[model samples]
Target: MFKGKNRFQSILLFILDLSILISSFYLASFISFGDFNPNYYYYSLLLGWGIIWVGVVLKYNLYEVPRILYVDKVLSKNFSAITVFIVLSAAAIYFFTSYKFSRIFFITVVSLFSFLLLIFRILFLYLVKSQRLKKDFRKRGVIIVGMNQNIQRLISRVYSRPQYAFFIEGIFTDTKLKGRLKNNHKGGLDDVKDYLLTNNPKEVVISLPHSYGDYIDELIHIADNNLVRVRVVPEFSEYLSQRFSIKYVENVPVMKFRKEPMQSLSNRILKRSFDIVFSLMAVVFIFSWLFPIIALIIKLTSKGPVFFSQERTGQDNVSFMCLKFRSMVVNTDSDNLQATKNDSRVTPFGSFMRKTSIDELPQIINVLFNQMSLVGPRPHMLKHTEEYRVLVNKFMVRHFAKPGVTGWAQILGFRGETKTVKDMEKRANADIWYIENWSFMLDLKIIFRTVFGMLFKRDKNAY
Candidate 1:
């Protein structure tokens, strides 16, 4: 039944997902309490749950993975998103305090919901494949204009996925050669226009070598007048790059180059929203509870204020005061000091705080205020920034985005004291690369790395 309109198929999938969530919630309540008592709190919980699930689906591209749907891929994506939502749900419950919903019910609901969604997707894929095999569906005919290694690979992949409903109309080579595959090579480059006009393909894949750069414009002009979708398979092996994105500047198309992936604008906004909301919650719930104890400890241990503020360069070269729990000797000059192993300036409690990263927690306020991100390049002191800007290439470019409390550099064992110019240079290089390839997945990876790095004492420079 899923045929023809792509928009209709997408809408159907969304409705299926919504149905799965609602049914799972109902089942979970029954499993937990043996009765259904829908209350205002239940309504609010369902609303929040739906928002998170939909947000995760959009963020992860779960709904846009081409035609063929693999059960494993669907389940893996669903589990990852559900895990994040579960964490967020727990945090919400802890902070709100007034919601007396059963924890068992929430966990059951999420687990059942994810399982049902996964099963539904698997069944849908199976049915679609079955229908395609038994029925004479109209397959989209595709033609490759150039015969190269990339084109050959594309042909092989498309041929393997029969359920994708794409028919290859043979590859056109530029030069004649011996031992050519039977019925594969149609003709030389000159016959491309004539062949297109005759066949009327739905799409054209242009696979050309990097050496054929000069001929790209001519090829584009040939396909420009046609209604068929045109795609280029550029020789990217020479670049050895990871991230690829297209952007327009003043009506001119430009490709963004980077070692890391670029985060989408929507995901960036979502992450920033998450940072603000969570930071505010931390300040209100956790920090408010812990401040008096921290202050008492600091006051008894040394003769300084409870908090220490430092001038650091944030996103776009904007300066901000980064706050931290006081973790050093009272009279020490902060400007010249870099915490080192066995540093006499650090008090007993201060040393513990530094090792545990508790001293850095107050910067949650900075995150909430938009002066910093939850993850990015670590902000540098103004003096250090000046010193490193000269030593490291593209060092100042890291300031293109907001700095973070913890960052790629910190998690990668480049945190803390940079005793040598080379050390600082390496750190700055990592920071710049991180900025160029920012993504929500990359942020999650960094957070994972930081947790493991802390546990294993893997960061030698953290002192």
Candidate 2:
């Protein structure tokens, strides 16, 4: 009733990828040199190609779970893999030997191979999706162990995506729930062994909470004895989002509670470079002239400094001097006070700045100074940080990455005065979501939405 091995899919994809690579390389060679070389160096380069592709795919987790494939993500990763292969090939050929590699052939092969690989993946995913829609397609049998939110999510995913090759055989849990499938509920933790031998699923998903730690060994033994694959959903898995990543420390896999894209060196460099270039452009084109005019207005309309600096929470629980165009009269409650709508302290000009979010423009300098990101979780006043961290458990988690001037929370309408603890909690949730799902594309989307909102939308919360 079940497909023999899901690994067959990965193996097939691997072979197909290798064939595409080899064909691309040979076609490039024939087109460029008018002849194909089957020499030692050629085979060596092919071997290098294999190593690079496999390494990149494994490093990026291109083919980890067999049935749970993401074609779009795989497409993006394939581009990165091909790019890395090209650069590494160039470096290896440049230093190791005097063989003059044809730049044209290299270019042709790289482009063609990337395109072909992407096409293959796209076709494969579509085929899987469509084929699974048909009842006749062989489906990989899977069983869920334990009862938790993770189990519910797994059931939803498997049932929702019938196009995928996953066929849930049954569920095993100790909890008593009404109207569950017949014989699906195995007695308890002890019965997992007997269930496995009787119903050998190709994959078993263990979705128990931390309290079931003792049962893990038993389930593992059962799985091993039956030659079944086991997938464990970490305890309290809801604390982390879908993008949750794992890192091995001394061969122990540690789950990241928050997904910080900047944790990756490549992501960090890419973000920093963008911040530099963008901050420089803003400072030169916009700040160069706007600052003087805003200063003159502040000096004339208000009896305080043009820029207000206050302690704000930043990355790693560090405090930084956050600069903003002063929007209110100088007062003792400035640091701790939450600004409300139509506050008396707000100057006419200041109100306009706050309304348009022009008051936050100075934080471009913060981004330039590397104290903040252009898009992230918006920094809160130190007082708010301390208060909120007590009120909301995940409040300080936002500090895992640099705070931004305009952020996920702000764009989501969770910014400004929090009249209730729920408002602050919602903001904290949004901030954590941003941190967990940070990506260059997401940042761009947030930045775009912020700009659009500022231009067209009115923030009733802004005083």
Candidate 3:
């Protein structure tokens, strides 16, 4: 019953958005040219824009409202969709069509549509809240059939948010509780079948730990016999650090502890494509001239190689030769000792390069070679990797993606020397967070911040 309502709401939202798009185009025409009648060319343009808008919004999951809706989330999603739709529409016009559309009409249409989408979404949420508050609202009855912290949290969330339209019919657990499960206790596990027959709830939610596998199976069987839907909330929350997801392979369910958006092939492809294009541009425009000057300076000022290559941990904990413009004087302890502020081994010229981040620019070649990405966890020296893997919790989890020239850790001031174990742990945690929550936009944001910091902000951590 809840699923049917969700489907209905999605369809309703889809129709409303398309209607708003059509209305916005005609409205823009009336405002721009003083007539509601638009040309056939304009109509065709409108059709194209409508299709692109649908695709963009669907990708952003705008048709379905989140259970906990925030104003910032609503605005972000709508603005993201609008930006993509307008960019694509403008690109299509510039490339595929010869007819020059009026800039005023295009801007007016997009502005009107964007304004209407935000207003209607807020209005829709208000209406839904108002309707759910009414006594006539039909909330689905849910019977919880287990006891645990997970179950307790679920109950609290449902009861606190009446807008979700769930009525906790009762809770059934084998465990004896005095105060926690007293009010809603319909009896123990043996009474569940009888209560189901009598009450006939819309759904049964099972939240038993793995130890109670037998009880869970029996409850499922009973619920199925009574023609009631069953949903299981896994009790493995204690073992996970973040939200988990289940995937099916050959009809078998597999639970993953962390959700990595980069696991998607489309996202991987987009990141790689951006990396290739951006790296190529850097090599062509910046590196073409800057490399010779830096090499000459290093050679004139130093006694060793201009570039430094060292073994570092890459994706999947594999060893790769990481490249960088040599930023320190040649020393036997280079591999074992990390650079510190005012280090004796760093040359005067190298200090300037390291401070300005010019020393890391040579990794553009690594990106071009497909051994590194534009933005990811910074690769650590082999010694640091081996040492920190044992010291830091989930330290190796950051190796799930290719190491980057500058990463989440570096931009957040976790770069330079790590004098203690806690510093390395902080860097690893940031890297793991990035791996689990990566997006193309996030990479761009990191790049922008890294550049901005390098140009404007003075980093005390950078040596």
| Per-residue lDDT of candidate 3, residues 1-463 (tens digit) | 1155588888788888889999999999999999998777899888898888778866887766665555444655565677678789999889989998999999999899988987898798788777777878987788888787777877777754677777778878878766755877887777888888787788998877899898788878878888999999887875555778889999899877788878888578778988999999999998999999999999999899999999888999888888989988899998899898889999999998889898999999989888999899998899988898899998999999999988999888999889899998999889988888776657777999999987988788888
Which residue pairs come into collision in candidate 2?
A: none
- Each prediction's TM-score versus the true structure: 0.60, 0.68, 0.65
Residue 415 error, candidate 1, Å:
0.7
At residue 207, give the lDDT of candidate 2: 78
Q: What is the lDDT for 428 in model 2? A: 83
Q: In candidate 3, where is summed lDDT lowest over 10 consecutive residues? A: 67-76
Q: Supply candidate 1's per-residue lDDT for 22.
A: 88
Model 1 misplacement above 4 A: 1-19, 28-61, 66-265, 448-458
TM-score of 3: 0.65
| Location of the lowest summed lDDT over 10 successive residues in candidate 2 | 1-10
Candidate 3, position 43, lDDT = 91
Model 3 misplaced regions, further than 4 Å: 1-42, 48-62, 68-143, 149-171, 174-204, 209-214, 221-229, 235-260, 280-308, 346-359, 389-394, 409-414, 420-426, 448-461
Predicted candidate 2, C-alpha RMSD:
6.7
